[model samples]
Target: MPTGAAQRPSVSSPRKRRGRAGLVLLGLASLLAIRIWVMEPAVVDSDSMEPTLHPGSLVFVFKAAPQLSGIHPGDVVVFQSPQDNSMMIKRVVAVGNQTVEVRDAVLYVDGFAPDEPFVDHESIDGTHFSLRRIPPGEVFVMGDNRERSIDSRDFGTLPLSSLQGLVLGAGR
Candidate 1:
C-alpha cells in the first residue's frame, strides 16, 4: 500500500549504531590484549645505541619466549644493567661458549672479525680486552657508540636471565 518513496530505507537507527559501536570496541579490546600479553613499549633515554637508536626513540620489545633456544649475536636486546639494576639496551656481540676480544679497537669473536658497520665510534680507550668462552647462559653486549658506553667492557658479560625482551625496531 506504500509508495516507492515511502518504502525507501531510513537512516541507521540508534540500535544499529550501537551494534557498530560494539564491534569497534571489541576490536580495540583485542589489540589491547595483544599488547599487554605479548609486546611491551620501551623508551630510549641515552645515546648508548646512537647511529641505530637515539634518545627519545620509542620502541617495542617482544617479551622473551619461554623456550628460547639461545640469544644470537647481532640481536639488539634489553637487559638489566650489571652495575645497576636499571634497564639498558645493547647489541649481542658474543654468545655463550664464544670468545670475544677487542684488539687495537677492532672487535674479534672467536678469532674472526665481525662485520660491525653499525659501530659509529671507536672504543674510548682503544685498548685490548678479551673474554674466553663466555660462560653458559651469558652474553656479551656492547653499544654502537662504543666510545661512550658502559657495556661488557666495563661490567663484563650479563646473565641471560637479566634480559627482559628483544627490541623489534622503532615505532611510529
Candidate 2:
C-alpha cells in the first residue's frame, strides 16, 4: 500500500539517452540524402583554375542534369573526367553551336572576339592550338589560367551529359 507521493512516476535516464540517439540518427540520414541526391562539396586540387578557383579552395556542384539550368558560356562547371571518372572543374569556353579559334594571341568565337575579362592575364602565345568547331550536345571548357590548364584544347569537347554541374558560386 503506497501513498500518492510514492506512486508518482520515476523518469528513466535510458529514455532521455534514446531520444538523443534518435535525433542524431535523423540528422545523419538527412545529410546522407543531401550528399547523394542534391549536391556534393569538393576541393580544388590544382592551379588549373587559378585566379578563379585556387588549390585547396572548397566548391560545390549540383550533380543534376545539365539542362536543369542550361550550360552557359563563362559559367564555371565541374564534370567527370573523360579519361577517368575523376572530377574536373573548368570554365565553359564555348557551348554547342559555337566555333572557337585561337589566332594572333586571342580567342575568337564564331570569328568574333568575346570580351573576356577573365582571360586578361592568360598567355595564348605560341601554344599552337588548332581551331575547334564545338559540336552539338558538347561543350568546350578550359581553365582561366590557359597557359597551365589541361582542358578541351588537350582533351577535346566534353559531352554535356558528362558535366556534374555549374560551380554554384564559391564555398565558405
* Candidate with best lDDT: 1
Model 2: per-residue Cα lDDT over 1-172, one tens digit each: 6556656587769989899999999999999998886688999988888777889999887766376768888888888777777788998879898999876657777888777676654465655556778999999988877788888888899988888787888311
The lDDT per prediction is 0.81, 0.80
Tell me the deviation in Å of residue 19 in model 1. Answer: 5.9
What C-alpha RMSD separates each model from the true structure? 3.8, 3.9
**Model 1 global lDDT (CA atoms, 0 to 1):** 0.81
TM-score of 2: 0.80
In candidate 1, stretches whose alpha carbon ends up further than 4 angstroms from where it belongs are 1-28, 64-70, 121-123, 170-172
Total backbone collisions, model 1: 0
After the best TM-score superposition of candidate 1, give how far the Cα of residue 142 lies from its true spot, in angstroms.
0.6
Model 1 root-mean-square deviation: 3.8
Worst 10 residues of 1 by lDDT: 62-71
Mark the 10 consecutive residues where model 2 has the least summed lDDT.
120-129
